[model samples]
Target: MKVKSFLLTALAASMTFVACDNNDNEMGQLDNTPKSVSINLSNVISTRGAGQAIKDDSKVSLADLQVFFTNGTTLYKGKTVSGTEAVHYFSTKDDFDSRDDRVFHFLPAEVNKVIVVGNNGSKITEATTYADLQKKLAIAEQQDPQKLDLYKEVELTSVEGQDDLGHPLYKANVVLEPRVSRIEIGAFKYNAIAEGTPRKYTSIEVQQVMLNNYFTTADFQVGTASTVSKEEITAASVFGIFEKAAQAGATNPVWYSDVFSADKSADPATKLQVITLGVAAQYEHAYTEGNVRPAYHFFPKDDAIGTTNHPQVLVKLIGTKSDGTKEPLYLATSTFNPAVTADFAKIYVMNFEFDDEDLDNPQKCVEVTVDVMSWDVVPVTPEF
Candidate 1:
């Protein structure tokens, strides 16, 4: 698979920090005067895709922003030189209109590391160290696919020039990445069934699509390359599956979920747990190539955790019989390639194609093709 890259611009705000007094400094800080330092934040997405570069309308909203400072020996929460508050809140976009409003003040040495977090709420306010903040999990409800939770880490570097006061300056460009992954469902293509099939349907109308056995929470830290053992993965309470109940008179019902995990045994029945995508009724026809649905989002999943059973897509269909009767049919996609793991900031486009087959065998009736793209890029059908 060929991977493509795209740029998602974030808030163009600069943080300014000043120097403070430190007696027990290993680097031998001689300057006691306040010096200005600046830091900028940007977001870049890299994923496997075709040669098309399309832009998406997803914006980065920072309801709450927090900054942390570390110098490998000590950890400190960023605060203004005049105030004791470390966390900043912006209720509207206009709050960041003023240049002084975007500026942050923190005391640090010449060489240090800066960590920035956005929209994390008040979960990590009491966190005293960077390690404690990294272990925190961002829940599904707290995250929005449109307005993502952002995190970035950068090492501060000294700039050649200094401010008007003749104080030395330091700066760094920080790239904040989203903590969730997205999956989009494209148009469906119906194929002709083999001749002389036992059960034949005049037409098939897809009612709903879902993702089964997906994670509901992810760590705030990015690029965590460590893999958990199967026992540890099963013991964690981070997975969920969706279930739908039919209403008495409503044309479409609501979907609910519960904590779920597949059993260790390789049983096909265990793959039925799912979360509905809630596709619109007008775009539910299987034979129509123009009908497309909205994109669904979820957190990253470790491929090594479930060696045999990973996340799968489930499609609900209403098939019409030759005698004017309707029957319900369910089709599920095969397991994802274990080699291709779902990571943060990545977008997956899944196209589901179905043909008439035995209703009892749901997994074998449909063929699915997936195209992976970076977030903020328009999803397109890929050539096989």
Candidate 2:
């Protein structure tokens, strides 16, 4: 009886071992190949404080977004699982992640790093290399000079988990960096003269406005040349919207007061105009040649006060003298140095107030006070 019991136990143990071996073989047959990757873009949001009265107003759209991979030396192309060129052409922000159209598959173990550039209403193609990307940027800039390019990088050194089908799943998020700096020029005309003060001027009107020493992509590494000289790039004119108000009650006459900001605390008769411009931001490292930093201005240059070069003038305000003759008043210039950061957008709000300490000499240099308002909005994620 003892020998029978021992033999029965040995037979059961053998069967159990065979069953475990079969399960191992089945598991080994499952596919563990790297198929596709999922990206989450919902974390892209503005980093500015909500309490600020004024904020940076720039629209962000993922439609026509293009992405490629780089292993620091070699570049690899990525495409959607359906074989269509990979693009995040979503019209609305809703359901950014749930959509199956966002998934892209790359070559197995080839996606070491990725660079994503945001689309500002421009078509983008697959750039297999860094040189291709620079070339593409130049073409895009020429096509849409006013539009901006937001760039971000992602590292795929780590893997998330497996998909339902048991493929190697890699997940990432693309956070954007603002490649342009925003410039907002606010002009406030102080025409109100106290009863005892001397009359300063009859009236003033804004002529042409120009930005001096503004940086473009052509001024930096993204341009055609490896190095850009200051003389190669110069100033650009910003033709702002001008509205002429008719006499007191003229028919269909637009009131200047109504066109400016809602803050009507100033005299209704005072003249004011606001114009905004978007300029490309420069990288400090790009300006540095070797160990010495060149005199190149990485920050946006503002017209310095009392500078003979005519400080960066927002508008060439033509002031009417007491004799009814029109004269030029250098009323628009600021000393504000505006810069863009990696995590947020920098907007330079310049308020120019014109005042004459000695009313007797109205033609002399008018006292111009410039107040620079800096707003840091637009959040950017850390480098992956």
Candidate 3:
């Protein structure tokens, strides 16, 4: 059992939830969907870790398989609140191994959709990415204008691809209206922002493809292109990517002493490029006049938070006292993001709270640190 995993020293980071079961694996329930009839990604798969429990971040890339699921329902990332939903799966591939049970919990939203793509075509799986689908659909619309209408009802679903990881890969498809073209907002999910803006457009749908979250090395543009395991490198890559983003947009940069070791060796006055991941998150918010974003992050309080900057839960204080005692002493609020940036330009949002006596609320309240920095397109090692 030669098991390999990404060993990450917990950076200064925090997650907002921990929705897993003992056996250490469980997912959100799907809306009205049958358990017997899941969109299968694989009929079978070969792996040694069959009965062996999977640790977090371990992935297996699925090989050959078939996908089966409800053919004609417009599915998105979200599920019906009051109805039973179908479960999702992922295949066990060498390249993409399932961390735990490889279960695709259909959370009640689109962002959770794990993107899966077909062999080069735009048709993606539940694991497919929305952005990629949009890109491919746009290309198809431009390529074949005359055949556009004929391809109108063109939709896609997961074809059984692999096992465990198989189900998620194979059956996941763009669950949306058939023949009826639709589009959604990106980045921000706030309804008000979506309804108010028009930049958001419907992805071209003359072909069979959908949006998902299957990230790849294609996103980065340096060094030898290789697909690393999700847990092993995704978070690290996210840190690298944010580093690139920060470098590209940072201004009036400041560096802090490493959280691991308190050393003021680096001069704050001098522009410091590479900063520790922890300190970066502490200050990863927006500055300037006014950019009203929510402040405070809650945890399922899951310890193993994903490296990817995930949808954080908003914090709201609720009180009254449990023992039916005096009025609950309202403490403070907090904001947290699983951000792992190598370098940040502007000041990012803060996570620490002020003491009870410190009522100024000046430390980190009602503000977000929009880190404008560049991610590491290449590894920051001496060899490179």
TM-score, per-candidate, Cα-based: 0.61, 0.50, 0.17
Model 3 ranges off by over 4 Å: 1-349, 357-365, 368-384
- The candidate scoring highest on TM-score is 1
Q: List the residue pairs that clash in candidate 2.
A: 46-379, 47-378, 47-379, 303-311, 303-312
Ranking by lDDT: 1, 2, 3
- The local distance difference test score of each candidate is 0.43, 0.34, 0.21
Pairs of colliding residues, candidate 1:
3-48, 3-49, 242-274
Model 3 lDDT tens row, 338-365: 2423221011222322222322233212
Distance (Å) between predicted and true CA of 299, model 3?
Answer: 19
C-alpha RMSD of each candidate structure in angstroms: 10.5, 20.7, 24.7
lDDT of 2 by residue, 68-120 (tens): 56766666654666676665444333544457665566444544566665544
Model 1 per-residue lDDT at 16:
39
Q: Write one digit per residue (lDDT tens) for candidate 1, span 116-193.
A: 776665545566666766654433342333345678767655444455554545566664566655555545544445
Total residue pair clashes for candidate 2: 5
